[model samples]
Structures are given as C-alpha cells and as structure tokens.
Target: MSKTVVFIQGSPRENGNTRALAALVMETLAQSGVASAEIDATRLQCSHPGCIACGRCQEGPEFRCHVDDGLARAVATLPDYDAVVLSTPVFWLGPTAQAKMCVDRMASLVKCSDAGALATPLRGKILGLFATGATERDENLDILERQYRVMAEYLGMPFVSALFPFCGVPAGQAAADPEFATVARDFGVRLAGMLGGRKCCDP
Candidate 1:
C-alpha cells in the first residue's frame, strides 16, 4: 500500500519561504507516488486556552478532544496517515502562534487511564520538521528543532528528520533560489521512499 503523509503548514503567510519549501516537498512526494495532504494551521478555528485539561479524552479508550474546532477534526484523522510533516517559520525564536496552537491541541492524542498511566495514539508514527527563518544564524533553528524533538519524544513518535532551508531569505525570494527548491524536493523524495520501506539518505 502507498504511504500517506500529512503536511501541516504553520505560517500565516501563505506565500512565505516555509510554505514554498513545503510545496516543493509535497510535489516531490506526489511524484514518488506517495499520497499527501496539506493543512493550513492559520485557517483552523482554534482559540486561546487550548486544551483545557478537562480530562474528557481520558474518559474512554477512544481518544478525542471535545473542542469543537478544526483542530479536533484534524487530530481525529491523523491516525489514518503513515507520517506527518510540520512546516513552519521561526517567529521570535520559536514557532508561530498558529503552529503552537495546533501543537497544544494535539494533547488530545494522549489518553490518561483511571490508573494515571498515559498512552498516545500517535505512538510509532514518523514525524518530520521543516522550518525557515529570516536570519541566517542557526540559533533560532536549533531552538525550533529541539522543541520538535521533545514533542516527538513525548508522543513516542520517531523524529525522522528536519529540513531547514531558505534561511535569511525575504518573503517571495525563496522561490528564486533554485538550490533551495532542489534540496527540498530531494528531501521530500527521500522521505517518501523511507515511508515506503526504501531507505535513503538521512533527512
């Protein structure tokens, strides 16, 4: 069976450098015969006080967040996909608010039993991170990567790889960098191959 991937875009600017790289990745995945979907975090109807810790999802074996929003619907469908790609731009040395909101909403994946033991529905899933920043320095990127790594670990998911491209580039300029697109596409192809049980270079 062909592997399916969900690419979540966390940037508010639809045409930003992050989205450009994500688009290239998606295109390459499609060429490799891997089905892919894109979710725009900015468009989700998520609000503040995310994940109220209401213990609603813990009440049953089936995990589901009671929040009536797009994020709930998105999380409900994640188990159907083989892998997930998170694409975001660095904002103040971290992910954008939209991205963080989605991340917080993912708490629904964790099911706390009456005994207090925790289990996640996302266990063993493959996760990849793609991020961009306006600065050429890697400090911000390091912070972002660390955050993602921690999240993956908490969820018991494998942090396959991270693609950081188009750094220091202004909006709309990333598309002009042929090398950026080329590298992004290569990473995408490799990711798709990995999902299909064909090992390629490390992400």
Candidate 2:
C-alpha cells in the first residue's frame, strides 16, 4: 500500500545543503510509489506563542490548534501521513528556529498521560530526521539527534534513524561529500518501507 510522507524543510536558504539532502530523500521515496509533500517552513511564517495551560484538544479526538497560520495548516496535516521527515540546518548545534517553531506548535496534540485524553494522533507513525552542518563533529551531531528524539517522543511517533551530513568548512556545501547524498537516498527508501509496513494511513 502507498503511504504519505511529509517533509518539513527548515532552512532559510532554499537551495542550501539541508534542502539538497531533503530533496534527495524525496527523490528516493518517489521510487517506492509513496505520496510525498513538502513544506518550507523558512519561507512561511510560523508563530509559536508558547503553549498555554489550556486543555481544549485533549477534551476530544478533534485536531485543533489555537494559533492560525501556516504552522497550524502543517500540523493539521500530520495525522494524514504515515511518515514524517524533518530536515534542518544546524543552528547553534541544534535545530533551527523554523524547525523548533513547527515542533513546538504541536502542543495541541499532546496531553499528559494521567489527563485521560484520547490517544495522540501521531502514535505509531514513523519519524525520520535529516540535518546538515558546517563541520563534521560528533558532539554537534549528538545535539541534533537528541532534539529530534525529543520531538518524536513528545508527538508519540517512533524515533527512527537520523541522517546527518557535515558539509565541509563552508556551511552550505553538502554536495562536496557525495557519499552523504547516497546516505540520504538510503534513508528515504528505508523510511518508505517502514511507513508501508506500519499501515499508518489516517482517517
């Protein structure tokens, strides 16, 4: 069966290294007949008014958010996809502002376990991550990996493998490392297989 894969591009530079890697992944996924959609958060304005103590969404199965913007539209589409991929350039050794805003705005779907809310819509879905950085360093990659893991856990999505490519000294030069592009392609194929096996099509 076919599956939906949503890719969130978090780079402000449209053709930066991070975006190039994300494009490679999308191309690979196309070979598997998976439905793919992409959103460039950097080009869109996403306002994140820190989460309030409100519990409206937890009151029912409805998917709703307080803020209205591109981020809300993107959040509304999450449950419809079998897999989600977040691509971002390393900012201060972690996720960029665009990526962080999108993830933070998803608070509407998360309710405390003891709150007796319905299951999160993201549960059981496959989640993947791709990141690009200026230099290849174990420490910085660790930071990026942990940030994605936290996002997956909070959203109730399965934390899958993360593909990180350290572009050479120059920040936006991932193509310089051809091997990294191959890795991105492989990541895409594997994620597609996981989504197909999970049968995570939304209602």
Candidate 3:
C-alpha cells in the first residue's frame, strides 16, 4: 500500500513562494511514487481569535476541539496519515497566524493523552518542517526550527527534518534560488523514501 503524506500549507497567498516551494517538495515525493495530500490552512475556517479556555471537548475523543472549525475536521483525520509536513512563511520571526492556529488547535489531543503514552493523533508518525522567509533565514529559520522541535517533542513524534528556503528578496524571487529548490526537492525525496520504506503498514 502507498504511504500517505499530509502537507500543511500555512501561507495566505495561494501561489506565493512558500506554496511554490511546498509544491516542488510534493512533486518530488510524487516522483518517488508516494501518496500525498496538501491541506491549505488559509482556506480552512479555524477559530483562533482567542482562547475561550472552555473545558468542553477536554474529555471526548482526543481529536475534539472546544472551538467549532476546520481544525476539528483536520485533527479528526490526521492520524490516518503516515507522515505530516508543515510549510509556512515566517511572519514576525514565527509561523504565520494561519499555520499557528491549526497547530495550536492540536493541543486538545496532546492534553488528553496520558504522559509516557503516545499522543493520540501523531503517535509513531513522522513530522517534517518546511519554511520560507523574506530575510535573515538565520534568525527566522531558527525560530521555526525550535517551534517544530518543541511541537514534535511534545507530541512524541519523530522530528524527521526541515527545509528552509530563504526568499527574503521579493514575491517571486524564491524560484530563482536554484540551490533552495534543489534542497527542497531532495527533502521531498527523502521524506517519501522514509515513509515508503516503513515496516508498519498504513492504518
């Protein structure tokens, strides 16, 4: 069976540099013959406006979220995939608001899981990070790296790898960065290989 990969796009621009890089990675994975799905958080309806801090959904299925939004749907089905990839643009030295909300909504799952036990949705799954920034990849990339590392560690998932394409020049300039594209492609190929070569079958 094909290993399913879920890619989360966190940029608001549908065809922006971040999305372009994400597409290239997905294409490379396809060349390796892996099944993949791309979820654009910009198109999803998520309520991160403010934390209501409500206790509702704190006990139900681990995927349940207190807020009613697209995050709930995504969380419900995330466990079915073998690998998860998050692609986002750096906004104010961190992930764009769109992507942050989706990731934060996953808190419900992690909170409900018993310590020392695998988190409900991401247990045994591989997590990958991909990001783009306007300038100073050194700083922005570091922030994203730490964020994903903490996130993966908390979820008890393997932090596989990350691809950072520095596109701080302009809107469509990332395409001109041949080296970045090469790295992105390689990342995709490796991700596909890792998931495809897994011993456990898809659940």
Candidate 4:
C-alpha cells in the first residue's frame, strides 16, 4: 500500500513561506507516488477548548474526545496517516497561535487504559517539523526545535527532521530562494523513502 502523509500548514497568511515549503514537500511526495493531505489550520473552525482532563476517552474501548469540533476530527484522522508534517511560521519564537492551538488540542490523543497508564494514539508515527522565520539566528530556531522534539517524544513518535528556511518576512519572500525549495524537496524525498520502508543512515 502506498504511504499517506498529512501536511498541516499553520500559517494564517495565504501563500506564506510556510505554505510554500509545504507545497513543495507535497509536490515531491506526489512525484514519489505517495499520497498526501494538506490541512490549513487557520482555515478550520477549530475552537479547541484544550483538554479538560475528562475521562471520556478512557471510559470505553473506543477512544474519542467529547468535544465536537475540528480538533476532534484532526485527532481522529492523525493516527490513520503514516506520517505527519507540521509546517508553521515562527511567531514569538514558537509556532503560530493557530498551530499551538492544534497542538494543544492534541492532548485528547492521550488515552488512558484500564490500568490507568497513559498512552497516546500517535505511537510509532513519524513526525517532521518545518518552519520559516525572518531571522537567521539559531536562538529562535532552537526554541522551535526544542518544542517539537518534546512533543514528538511525548507522543512516542520519531522526529524525522526539523527544517528551517530563514529570512522569510512580509510573506512570500522565501519563494525567491531557490535553495529553500531544494532543501524542502530533498527533505520530502527522504521522508518518502522512509515511508517506503527504507532505513535511513544517520550522518
């Protein structure tokens, strides 16, 4: 079966740098005969109220959130995909508010078993973080990467990579950088290869 990857774009601006990079990645994945889905978090009517510590998901064999919203839908669909790519623009040294909201809502994925041990539906999944920013400094990038790394660890997922193409401001600026496109495309190819059951050597 062909692998399916979901690309979630967290930038509120249409045609922003993050979206452009995500598009490039998706295009490359398509060329490799991999299925892809793009989810624009800003476009969704996601009023995620965060996790209320409700024990509903642990109440039955079927794990689910009581909230009826787009976030609930996202949590349900995320586990079905083989890999997930999160693309966002740096805002205040972290993911944009829209992206953070989605991430916060993901707490619902943590289901409690009858033994009361915590578990997440995201186990064994592959996750990649892609971001763009106006600064080329590592300070902001470090913050973003740390956050993503922690999130991946918490969900029991392997962080495939974190790609940051910097100096993107005023939107669409990164489009002029051919190097950024090359990097994004290469990252996509590698992710596609991994999805195809290829082992990646660490360098």
Candidate topping lDDT: 1
TM-score of candidate 2 against the unseen true structure: 0.83
Candidate 4 deviant stretches above 4 angstroms:
47-49, 52-55, 112-116, 197-203
Candidate number achieving the greatest TM-score relative to the actual structure: 1
Q: What number of clashing residue pairs does each candidate have, in the order they appear? A: 0, 0, 1, 0
Per-residue lDDT of model 3, residues 83-132, tens digit only: 88888888888888878776766666664445555446687788888888
User: Residues 21-101, candidate 2, lDDT per residue (tens digit)?
Assistant: 777777777776777898777765556533454666566656667666677777778778888778877788877887777
What is the C-alpha lDDT profile of model 1 across 79-128, one tens digit per residue?
78888878888889888887777677777778766797769768888788
Q: Cα-based RMSD of the predictions, in order?
A: 3.3, 4.6, 4.1, 3.8
- When sorted by TM-score, best at the front, the candidate numbers are 1, 4, 3, 2
Q: Order the numbered candidates by lDDT, best leading.
A: 1, 4, 3, 2
In candidate 4, what are the lDDT values of residues 1-203, reduced to their tens digit? Answer: 87899877888988688887778888788778788997777866655455566667666665567677877777668788988888888888888877776676676677765687778768888888888777774868777888788888877898866466455655666656788878888888888887873332322
Query: lDDT at 171 for candidate 4?
Result: 67
Better of 1 and 2 by TM-score: 1
Q: Which scores higher on lDDT, 1 or 4?
A: 1
In model 2, the number of clashes is: 0
Judge candidate 2 at residue 171 and give its lDDT.
46
lDDT of 2 at 104: 66
